[model samples]
Target chain A: MDFDIKRLGFTLLGLLIVLNWGLLMSSIMRKLGARVAKRYGIRWFQPWLDLVKNYALRSQISHGIMFYLGPVFRIGGGVGLFLFMPMIIGSELWLNYSFHGDLVLLMYFQFFGMLGMALGSGEGGHPYSAIGISRGLSQFTTIEVPMTLAIISLAIQYDTLSLIDIVKAQQGGFQNWTMWTNPVATIAGMFSLLGALSHSPFNLVKAPNEIPIGPPTEYHSTFLGVLQTNAAILHVVEAALFMNLFFGGATNWFEFILKTFFIYFWSVFVGVVFPRFRIEQSVAWFLKIPLVFGVLAIILYM
Target chain B: MSETKNNNKFENPHYAKREVTGPDGKQFIVDPIKDYFSDERPKVYEPNSIPVVEKFLNWARAESLWVLGFGTGCGSIEIPPLMTPRFDAFRFGIQSRPTPRQSNVFIISGYLAVKTLKRVIRSYEQMPSPKYVLALGSCTINGGMYFDSYNTINRLDHYIPVDVYVAGCMPRPEALLAAFNRLKELIKEGKGEKANEYAANFDWYKENQKKIIKDWNMPDYNW
Candidate 1:
C-alpha cells in the first residue's frame, strides 16, 4: 500500500541494504561461532559462495507445484517482513513500506513463510521433511507464546499497534528503551528469538544428522539457493525487528549494523554454550520459563 | 524380514533369484530383482556451464563443499579429527553435512562391504549434480587390509567415479586436509565435476556395484 511510484527507488535501496547486511551478519556470526571452537572458521563471504553454488547447480527435480513454490513462499515471507518494517529512524529511504502496515500485520505475515515451507516440505514427500515440519510447528507454537505476549505487553504500554510508534516512544535516551523499562518482556522476547533463529539449543527441528535439514531435505540446487537467499535477509530483518522494538531502533546505518549484529550474537552466544534441546524439551522450557516472564511482563504492563 | 531372506539366499543358494511353489500347487519363478546396475545412458542435467561462468561456479563449488559425513567403513575415524581444533576443516568452509540433498561431496572413508556399498551407491546418487567423490584409504583404491575378504569390495572407483584418493590405511587428518586442498584445486579448475561423469557411465558403475552387492532392492536411480 505504501508503493508510491516516487518512493519505489528508496524501497529497492532499503531491500538491498537488508539483503547485503543479512548475509554479512550471518557470515560474521559464523566466523565468530568458529572462534569459540578455536577454528579459523569460513571466509567472510562463505554464505554468498554457498548461495552461488546452489544457484549454479545444473539439475533439480520437482515433487509438485508446492514443492517448487516452497522456496518461493519462504523468500516471499522474508521479503514481505523486511519491506513492511522501517529499518532506520528519521530517514525516508529506510522507512520502506511501513506506513501502510501496523505491527499486527508484521506479526501475522511471519507465518506465511512457515506455512508455505510446511506445505512445500509436505509436497516434498520425504518423511524427514514431514518430521521437520512437525518439530518446527510444534516448537513454533510454543515460541509464539512468549513472543506474542511480549508484543501485546509492548502494544499496551505504548498504546499503539505500530512498530514505528513503539520505536518513537522509546527514543530520546537509552534509559527509555524497552529493554531497560520492560526487562521482563525483553528477556521473554530474547529467549524466543533464539528459538526463532533455530540456534543450537532449539535447533531440534533441523536435527542435523537425524533428519538431514528437515524441511528442505529434497531441495537441491536453485531451490536451496532461493531458501538460503531468503534466510540471509530473514535473519537480519528478524534481528532488526527486535532492535526496533527493544533496542530503541537504529538512528543510522552504522548503528543499525552494530545494534543488530550484537542483538543476533546474543542467541549465537547461547547456541555455542548449549547443546541442542529435544523438541519436547524446548517446548516445555518455553512454556515454563519464558512464558512466565511473558505473562509477568504483561501483568506488569497492566 | 526381507533382508534376512536376501542374506539367506546369498549364503545358501548363491543366486539372486530362485524357483518357488505357489500356494495353489503351481510352480512359478520369483525374480526378486528389477532395475539393472546397467550401462544404460542415464540423463544428465546438462549444465551448459559457460567458460567464464564455469570458472566462477567451480570456485564457488570448491569453496563451499558440504561433505556427506557418511562412514561406510573404518576410515570415518580419520574424519572426526579433521573437524577438531587441530585440523579445523571449517576454516576451509568444509563441514560434514547430515544429508545428501544439501551435500556436494561424498567421502568414501574406507573398505566398502557389499552391504554398505549398496547404501553408498544409494546415497551417492541422492546428492545433487556437480558433486565430487573423495575416496579415502588404500581400501577404497585396492581394498586395503580387507582385500582378501569376500564381503568387502576390492576397488572403490569401480563402483563410483572418484575425483580424489587420499592414500593410506587411515590417512591422517593432515593428509585428509591436503587431499581436500587438492580436491578444492580440482574443483576450481573445473576438474572436480565427477557427477556428470558418473551420469555418463552410470551403467558401468552399476554393473561393477552389482557384481558384489547381490540383493538389488533399490531403484535404478536413487532419486
Candidate 2:
C-alpha cells in the first residue's frame, strides 16, 4: 500500500508524542504528589489529591456534558496511536502506511495528549485548573528543548529519522538499542524519561498542598472518572513509547508488553525515590545537566 | 310457570347466567326486594375523576421545598452538620441545592458580606417562582455583628423580602429546626400568598438585584 509519509508521520507523531507523552508525564507527576504526601504522614493532602484524581466525581448534571466529553477525547487520542505506530516485527500488511518512523515525529506527537488535557481543564473553568495548565506548560517547555536535542543526536548517529531504521541500524545485539551505544546518550534518555513522566524534582503542575488539586479542582462526576482511566492507560503508552524508541520493538507481543511494563515500573521507582522540584529548579536542573548529556551525545556523533 | 320455562330455553347462547354467592354460605337468588335494598350494590358510574381533596394532597406532597446554601457569615459553618449524618435535613424534603433554579428557600445563615450580599440577591432573583427567603442568625435580621457598617444590609427586609427570621449571632441547630418547622407550618397554612406577591413584582426585584450586582461591579448575571 502506497502511504503518504507526511500524513502517516503526522498522525503517528500526534498520537505518541503529543497526546500520550504529555498526559503520561503530567499524570506521573500528579501521582507522585499523592505518594509523597502519604509518605510524609500528611493525611490532609488526601482530599486535595482525591480532588485532582477524581476531578469529575461530583460534577453537576448541567456540566456533565463537558465533563464526559473530556475523557472521550483523551481515550480517543490514545487509541489513535495503535493504528498509527508502525509494526516492526508484525507483517507490513497490517499497516496501511509504510515509511521509516521519524524520531522528530514521535517527539511532536507526544504533545497531543497534553493539548487535550489542557483543553479539558480550560473548559472546567476553575482557577486552580488554569494554574495547573500554566505550570504544566512551563515544565513541558523546559524539558522539551533538551529532549529534542537528545532525539536529534540519536537520529544523526543512525543517519535516519525513522525509528525503525534507527533500531535496525543497531541490530547486532541487545546492547545496540542505543543506550549502551554511548553512556551520555543513555543518561540523556533516562533524564528525558524523567521529564516525560514529570517525575519528582520536576512535578510542579499538580502540586496538591499549594494548589488544592490544581487543574481538576472543579471537575466532578464522570468527568473525573474518565481522567483516572486515561491516566492509567496513558502510563502504559508512555512506557511503550520509551521502549519502542530506546529499546528495540519487541520480537513478540508478550515481550512487547513485558518490556513496556518493565520500563513503567522503573519510571515509577524513580518517581518514588525523588522529592519534587519547584518550577524554576526543575527548569534549571533539566537544562543544565541532562541537556549537557544531549549536547555531548551530539558532539560524539559529529 | 310453563311460559317462563319456555323463555329460559329460548334465551340466546351468547348470554351466560352468573350465580351469586353470599358470605352466609348460601347461593344468592336475585330477589328484587332484597337486591333493591342491598348496601353491596355497585357504585353508579358518575364521572368519578380524581377527587379535589386527593388532588390537593398530591399537589402539596409534590411541592417539596428545597433550601439554597447561601450562608453569609459564622452561622454558615453550622450548616454542614445540619445537612450531613447528624441532622440529615434531606428527610424533611428540604435538600440543599447550590444554585437557585431548584431551591425554594434562601437561608441567609448570618452576617452578609458586602461581597456575599450581592451574590445572595442575584441568587434570590434567579430562583424560580414560589420562593421564600429565610434570614437565619440575627445578623441578617438587624445586622447582629455588623449593624453599623454601611456595607452591611442591616434590615434584610429592606433589600429582599424575608419570610422568617431566626435569632442569635449563630442560631443553634435546634433554633434552625424550629425555624424550619415554622416554615413548614407556614407552607401548610398556605401563607405563600406573600411569596406569590413578591414573585409577581419581578421588575422591582430585578432592579434591586441589578443594584447589588452593579455595586459590586459584577455582571447582572454570571452568563
Each model's RMSD to truth, in Å? 5.2, 24.5
Model 1: per-residue Cα lDDT over B1-223, one tens digit each: 0122555433433334566678888876655433223223456666455788778878888889899978888889988888877888888879777878878889888888888888888888878888899889999898788889988888888888999999997888899899889999998877775888888887888788777777675557767
For candidate 1, lDDT tens digit of each residue in A82-140? 88999889887678889779988888778789999999999887899999999899999
DockQ-derived CAPRI band for the predicted complex in model 2: incorrect
Q: Evaluated with lDDT, which candidate comes out highest?
A: 1
lDDT, residue B7, model 1: 51
| Model 2 spans with C-alpha error above 4 angstroms | A2-77, A86-101, B1-223
lDDT of 1: 0.85
Kindly list the per-residue Cα lDDT of model 2 for residues B80-188, writing each as its tens digit.
7776556655445455654454456788888876677777766665554456777888888777878888676677776678878999877787788778778767755
Ten residues in a row with the worst lDDT in model 1 chain A?
A1-10
Proportion of native contacts present in model 1: 0.86
**Compared with the real two-chain complex, what DockQ does model 2 have?**
0.02
Error of 1 at B136 (Å): 1.0
